[model samples]
Target: MHDQPWTTAPLVAFDLEGSGSQDHEHEAILEVGVVPLVDGHPDIRNAYDSTVNPGRRIQRRPWSSPGLTNDVLGLAPRLDAIEPELAGRLNGTSIVGHNVNVDWRLLSPRCPGIRPASLIDTLKLARLIHRKAQPRTLTALLAYYELDDEVTELSGGQPHRALWDAVGAGLLLGALIRELPHGGSLTVTGLHTVAGVSLGDAEQTLPLF
Candidate 1:
């Protein structure tokens, strides 16, 4: 793998809280958080998070962490209302997240015009680094790296909230990058190759509006 630093480019790490997992059906995004990273560190002052009215009841899943509920999202603005700001955050930046495909599936339909230049899936990266580790969820990876303590000190101290997850993902990415063999850094193309997917290609395959 080429040892080019990926942080030289603008990176936006984001997360989406959705009503459910079945994006093809009634599932919709309930909240979104975006954190722009500068030279491999999150710029919290410019971070963005918003509760989105999913236009349907927010389904509670057994696997989902607690916090999001119909009551919490009842008064939130709809996706269309926040589309402008959300798009602005995503525009012209590489994307990063844990299991980011899920976020893209739910987000692309809502903001068709904003297509990321590339993507770095932390889920995939974690597996690549720690192939034998079981249950490679974000929480598990954070704990494995001994980064959970820092995450717990975050503003909300909650796990599944959009902003918290986004920040956690960014931190996890930094840790993973540092652990790269021989002090190596990943290029955008290198990340895409390892991820075996591209946000640009995924966006093109999206249903035409």
Candidate 2:
């Protein structure tokens, strides 16, 4: 799995909208989205997205989860109801997201037995590709690459939503993969030096081939 290039190995880009909490322990997932990548393109046809009822009121924050009211969230499935589907799509797949570990920290505990074969952090990739780029957030990075419109069209939803961010991360990944400094084709393992799961590991970029 480590040696497989993203162009060949399967990748599942995912995002989890949480209960507006910074601490993973307190962050209940409000929604989830996953889009598989094929040939460097997001296959939205097979995409999975749903609002998961947190079983409690989601604290309101400015722009946290726009238009998702308690009434709306209450009607959605609980995490346990969707656990199998989430694990089916995520486990053993190469996972991609802007700050992926954050999602993992929140997701892994709730969905036991869920794990990924590899992780790619587009936030780290953006810094490596464009050192002087400003505001490396997912929204900013998509705009930086001029991919915002396409991702928006593909997602058909606004930012901060799981599906929209999933599609954005999938597209952002394809763009970043093309701009990698490595010569010729690159493998999933090759991106680890700059886009490893943790911030500390991603900071150490020694030659690895």
lDDT of each: 0.75, 0.80
| Candidate 1, superposed: residue stretches over 4 Å from native | 1-4, 22-24, 200-209
Candidate 2: segments with Cα more than 4 A from true spot: 1-4, 22-24, 198-209
TM-score of each: 0.86, 0.88
The sequence of per-residue lDDT tens digits that candidate 2 reaches over residues 1-209 is 66876567678889988875553356688889999999878999999999989888877878577767899899999999999898899888878888887777667767876767778788878887777847688998888789889988999998889999999999998888788666247876676666767523333332121
- Name the weakest run of 10 consecutive residues (lDDT summed) in model 1: 200-209
- Give every collision pair in model 1: none
lDDT, candidate 2, at 90: 85
